[model samples]
Target: MTSRVLYLFGSAAPPVHDIAAVVRTAQNRGFTVCLGLTPTATDWLDPQRTELERLTGYPVRSRYKRPGTADVWPKADVIAFAPATFNSINAWALGITQNFVVGVVAEGIGKGIPMVTMPCVNAAYAAHPQLDRSIETLRGAGIRVLYGEGGFVPNAPGQGRPPAYPWHLLLDAAEQAASTP
Candidate 1:
């Protein structure tokens, strides 16, 4: 296919609410966007499920399909997992594939799928030390993690979400990953 497929996964973070806009932005950048979400994120966006499926031209899948079910989304050329939550990140890094989103990304590592992840976490969670280890683990596995300096910086709890979540940086890294061959 000439157009690369972008598997965009979001967690339960607040920024996931802006996914429709992000899908449009990714489309404008020439990706065929396919959106997936953590189970709670899917519940959070249930009302917009139809619209999101329409927006991305694919089913919004959270739960794993039954055995023998065919995969619906196109083969992903690159994955941009942004607004990943503390729980999702930790679970993903630890190889806990309880959720569909984390399962794909966990397998994406071995599938040779180029991937980018930007965590949307609070300062309290970011300071837990496990977050740092998880980020390093992902990086060691060739996944570009947009955390700490030059990427996403955690905000203080109760301070509200950051106005900008560095979507550009994450998308830029995704673009680069797809082109690396």
Candidate 2:
């Protein structure tokens, strides 16, 4: 069976370093991966777009197509939102689909496709009143949110650096969520 995993990139510190590893790891685990990046995330990965497309055998989409145009990617069996940032997390929870990545994820949730989210916010950001509620809302929608122990935890702001991103954990959580009934 072919498991098509749509990996959505958010503007966070981790994916900038771990995207390649994430793709390779998922592929090794029998997933056919496609990439969708937030506009800012796409800017960060712009130089590697061609290489990343080559790696996944699918184009990296960061923008919506013209109204009459067709989608360039295959139907996704699972959606993985890695390095999900504070802004993206809130935007997604509020059903704001201004960007391609969030739009796809929102629609996927409505369709009841298996979905996973690995947030990469700092402690200050996480403390925002809306953040916790947003997470709870997403979890209520059946999204497997990878947070706290064994997943992502907040760091101190202005640290100027981050610990190793848990890319493997993101894929692992996604795989488990996808296997759920």
Candidate 3:
């Protein structure tokens, strides 16, 4: 069976332009990519959601279903939070499951699934006291939080973009995590 990669997107800079490449890269790696978008991310991706679904052969979800609604997607083999924003990072770390993506992350932790998170916040935001603790907490829980070289490094706040964020790094990390014992 094909491994399912559940990609959770937050409102971060790279995703605004690089999401298609990310999806294609995951598919190339032999994953069935399912997208879970944060509300803000969904708003940003609304124009292309249809195209994205076409590319991945699955729907892009941002909200929870109504009561009695059936889940239409496959169970995730590996879950990745890409372009993980400061808000999303904090929310997930704090156990705040107010949104679909965050809720999935919270549940993924309990499910004992291999998971990876690639944060895309800038230097100033990354410097927040909560961010370090959050990353530490996540790492402590067996979540692979990819940062620094080969992943994301904080750019100066307001500098308007860091050196091209390594979107591919997320795919590699997720695959590795999924395959590990």
Candidate 4:
């Protein structure tokens, strides 16, 4: 069976290259990618969104407005938010779904869907009191937060590479989660 993967992008911290790599790798593994981007991320990546849509064959969205009043949104098998910003993380943990990405995440969480959030905020923001609480809340709500090798950071100088065997690790985790009875 094909797995539907939702790629939620926050700001520029996590690096567009990382997001694109993950999406491409997931696609090669028979997973369909649906991109949900934040306005800041859109600004940072600009035309890359179009390239992503072409690669995934699905429309990319950065707003909360529905496609059509009567149209139903597509449900995803797995929701993965990469480079989640501090604002988005806090909003999501607090049940704020004003945007399309957060809305889908809130709905998915309520439905007991598996979610993986890779936050890419600077060190100071990650250390903030509210941010820590938000991260804890996300964890408390059963969301998987993938911490990169070095740890969470608000802004890294360059696009850091995922650990070796990143795709395999993600695939294994997804498979294990799917196998739960």
Q: What TM-score, over all chains together, does every model reach? A: 0.97, 0.92, 0.92, 0.78
Candidate 1 regions exceeding 4 Å error are none
Largest TM-score belongs to which candidate? Answer: 1
Worst 10 residues of 1 by lDDT: 158-167
- Please, what is the whole-model Cα lDDT of each candidate in the order they appear? 0.92, 0.81, 0.81, 0.66
RMSD in order of candidates: 1.1, 1.7, 1.7, 3.6
Work out candidate 4's RMSD over C-alphas: 3.6
Write candidate 1's Cα lDDT for 29-126 as tens digits: 99999999998999999999999999988999898889998988889999999889999899989999999999999999999999999999999998
Q: Clashing pairs in model 3?
A: none
lDDT score for residue 49 of model 4: 73
**Residues 76-101 of candidate 3: C-alpha lDDT, one tens digit per residue:** 88888888888888889889998998
Q: Pick the candidate with the highest lDDT.
A: 1
- Model 4 — which ten-residue stretch has the worst lDDT? 157-166
Better of 1 and 2 by lDDT: 1
List runs of model 2 lying over 4 Å from the truth. 1-3, 160-163
Candidate 3 has an lDDT of 0.81
Which model is ahead, 1 or 4, in terms of TM-score? 1
